[model samples]
Target: MVQSERAKMADGEWYACLDDDLGALRGVAADAVFEHNTLPPRQRGNLGPALRALLGGVGEGARIEAPFHCAYGFNIFLGPGTFLNAGCIILDTAPVRLGKGTLLGPNVQIYCAEHHKEAAGRQAGLEIARPVTIGDNACIGGSAVILGGVSIGEGAIVGAGALVTHDVAAHTTVVGNPARVVSRG
Candidate 1:
């Protein structure tokens, strides 16, 4: 999996775009620290607009908590009425599609790219990308990491701390590292 210098340069460019999008997020993170001390969080008003401006395109009524991070806002796409709890991170180096009505619990990380495991390739900072797709109405529990090229089927429930490396069947529940289908929810 040897990669060219051009690929490395492209990855660096992607990183730069991410830096630009997250520039506002740095302030959002700072705001969260003080936001909790306020009398009412609702009184603070919905900050969804602020976040939407930061991401690629956040659909109507999508609520994303503070302290969220994404690489290259252009690489991410989220549907309407989706809720992402605090500490959600997306490395959308490729493309990440989140369907409508999806719920992402705290600490969920979706990564859309991976570096070559070969030591020489890694040394060059070369990488490759694969898109991640989470289907409609799916619920992903806290601390789950959805890796690249994974398609989590519609209405599937991914348990807490699951490291999903494969595609999940529709309308099922999966758990554990390299997640296994536990039941049909």
Candidate 2:
């Protein structure tokens, strides 16, 4: 049976992060990420078998370039033809779903956890998991950061270096910190 902390994490509930079970899960992800990162370029097409096996789901043609990092691979799902460029990082404490044809440029970061606000709770390692979803054909530009609980609708575009903290409507283009909608296709 999975530990209570892990079960709570998977359920998207607030849980203490100091548990041994959670650390073990993170260690597994670290090993996989390390293997993928150190693999020869020619042998690491799409994703290395070790890394691929750790993920929850990988659709046909989905690819994540080397130097990719994730906290918990089992919570990530990539739809068909989705691509993540080099230096991408995903803290998948909760589910992170990337839809078909979605593209993430270099250095993109996706976070799925929010730490406790109070100092005492933070000291206690309390955190809550929130799912992040990117719909089909969306593009997240280089150096962008997608915060937990944010959803980007189909065909949305997030400009380079943007910080997204809110939902982005379908066919819209957003830029800048806090991600203001600049245009809609």
Candidate 3:
């Protein structure tokens, strides 16, 4: 059976990123993002209605500060009391789950898409997506980059400027490129 590009993407299979249907979906997400980004803080509150409606799930008291961006809002799920500071970007081509009370500092980037390595496939806009999961009460410092398929354990601390490419164990503090375990917090 032939699956839609989005279906393929959600199933973690290779898909065409430039597909028309996917483009329309992204456009819808962009509109919601626009509503969140343009509205004044006072008017916007934490998560605006449009943006909230667009997301897959947003738990009670969860707040996403504006100047935020995402490839598709529907793929993101935020737990209750989770706080995402300003300038956070999520490429939610796949599901991105942030557990309750998780805090992401400003300018944090979460990437869910991995492009094809071959030049021909890359030019064709081929790519695969993987889910990113951050456990409850975790703290991710500013400017950290969390790559796809990485699962951050509960209460884990990711240091600023760290590049996370693998799973981070619970209660561990990881710093530096490749995110080595510096301490067990």
Candidate 4:
């Protein structure tokens, strides 16, 4: 049997972004996100449970500040000690893995989905997805945008406002648009 559009999406293949099943899943995620985002920050009692229910997996000591946005919460995996500051947006069309001790500053944007390079394909709502992985002890500064298919290696540092379109080597520091390594530890 041929795969459904949702299956194709999960498999990281090209798929229709406007598929009914995918839209339904996104709706569910939106509702959950809305509930989580509406709660007052000081109300710590219910926050953890809410996030745990919404996300795929939330490890020990993982903390995601309110106002976080994702296409599908179930595609995001937060490792132990991962901290995501306010205003973080993860377009988790595919899996987005944040390893242990990773720190994401305010307004960090991670995108796992990309529209077709061809205008006609894009107009047809065709898209592709790729998983994004940020390794252990990585630090993504405020407003950094990590694009699809990028793997940031362990202990990598992405400076504020960086636009990362490619993989970053282990223990490297990258900054600026189409981020280039400024240093390697």
Candidate 5:
């Protein structure tokens, strides 16, 4: 979890900040790219417009494929040569940064915002933000769900369907639920 004093401010206070308030200020800015479909296609290629529109503010060399979804565009920053495949959903209520050459497989879900688990907080429908960082050349496999405030180090490979809830070291191979490293860097 993020222990920095800057990360712990209340939601109301945070939403008042310029950087953190973009999602609320521009809710669904890419709606033109996200058209309603009774049954959305399972394959990729339907996401190009959405990706382009979302990354309009980021660097020019960044690449994001179709069949992806994100909560807000500003909260995500992609380095050059980064690629996200089909069925990727990023709840980027907080910052989600992918380093250069980072590759994400199909069905990858990266979440930077999490709701409180406490009974009172849950009932109140409160959520908090944390950052997710994927280092250079990391490969996240299909159907993995990465939780808040976790970092995948450089050259790490996360196996398919893994649920990563903690930090992964550089060049490690992590698989299964909660994602234990099978090979050390």
Candidate 6:
């Protein structure tokens, strides 16, 4: 039997993003996100439980500030001591892994999905997904955008508003659009 669109998506192959199964999954994720975002600040402690029910994995002491968003919550994995500041958005069309002690500043955006570069394919809603990995102790600054297939190395620091399109080396500091390494140790 041929593979389903969802199966192809999981395998990181090109697939239609508007498929019914994927839409249903997104609906479930949206509902969960809505509930999590709507909870009062006094009940912030309950956020972990809410995320645990939605995400692929949520390690101990991981905290995400309210108003977070994601395309598919189940594709996100957060490690121990990870903290995502307010307004972070993760388009987890594929797996998005944040390693232990990683810190994401406010409004950070991580996208694992990409639409076709050509107009015809885009019009058809064809898309592909790639996994994004942030290694242990990495710090991503406010408003940074990490695009699909990028891997941030352990202990790397991404400056505010960086647009990361390629892998960052361990212990490096990157800044600016199409992020360039400014320091390496």
Best by TM-score: 3
Candidate 5: Cα lDDT at 135 = 97
Give lDDT tens digits, candidate 3, residues 7-93. 999999999999999999999989999999999899998898889999999999999998999998999999999999999999999
Give per-residue CA lDDT, model 2, range 31-144, as digits (tens): 999999999988988998888999999999999998999998999999999999999999999999999999999999999989999999999999999999999999999999
Candidate 3 residue pairs in backbone clash: none
Cα displacement (angstroms), candidate 4, residue 163, comes to: 0.6
Candidate models: Cα lDDT each: 0.73, 0.95, 0.96, 0.90, 0.72, 0.92
Q: Which lDDT tens digits does candidate 1 get at residues 6-87?
A: 3442454323222333445445533543442242547534443334455666777777666567655566778898888888
Ranking 3 against 6 by lDDT, winner: 3
The candidate, 4 or 6, that scores higher on TM-score is 6
Q: Candidate 6 has what TM-score?
A: 0.97
Colliding pairs, model 5: 47-66, 47-67
Please provide TM-scores, in order, for all candidate models, with all chains considered together.
0.76, 0.97, 0.98, 0.95, 0.76, 0.97
Which has the better TM-score: candidate 1, or candidate 6?
6
Per-residue accuracy of model 6 over 78-141 as CA lDDT, tens digit each = 9999999999999998999999999999999999989999999999889999999999999999
Give the per-residue lDDT digits (tens) of candidate 5, residues 1-185: 64332244223122222343443434564462364121244432333454455653444455555556777666688877787876788877677889888889998999876776677765654567778999999999999999988999999999999999999999999999989989987
What residue runs in model 4 are displaced by over 4 Å at the alpha carbon?
44-48
lDDT of 4 by residue, 1-185 (tens): 98998899888889999988989989988887777787777764324455568788888888888888889899999999999998999999999999999999999999999999999999888989999999999999999999999999999999999999999999999999979999998
Which ten contiguous residues of candidate 5 have the minimum total lDDT?
A: 9-18
TM-score, cand. 2 vs. native:
0.97
Clashes of 5: 2
Model 4: clashing residue pairs?
A: none
Query: Which scores better on TM-score, 2 or 5?
Result: 2
> In candidate 3, residue 23 scores what lDDT?
99
lDDT value for candidate 6?
Answer: 0.92
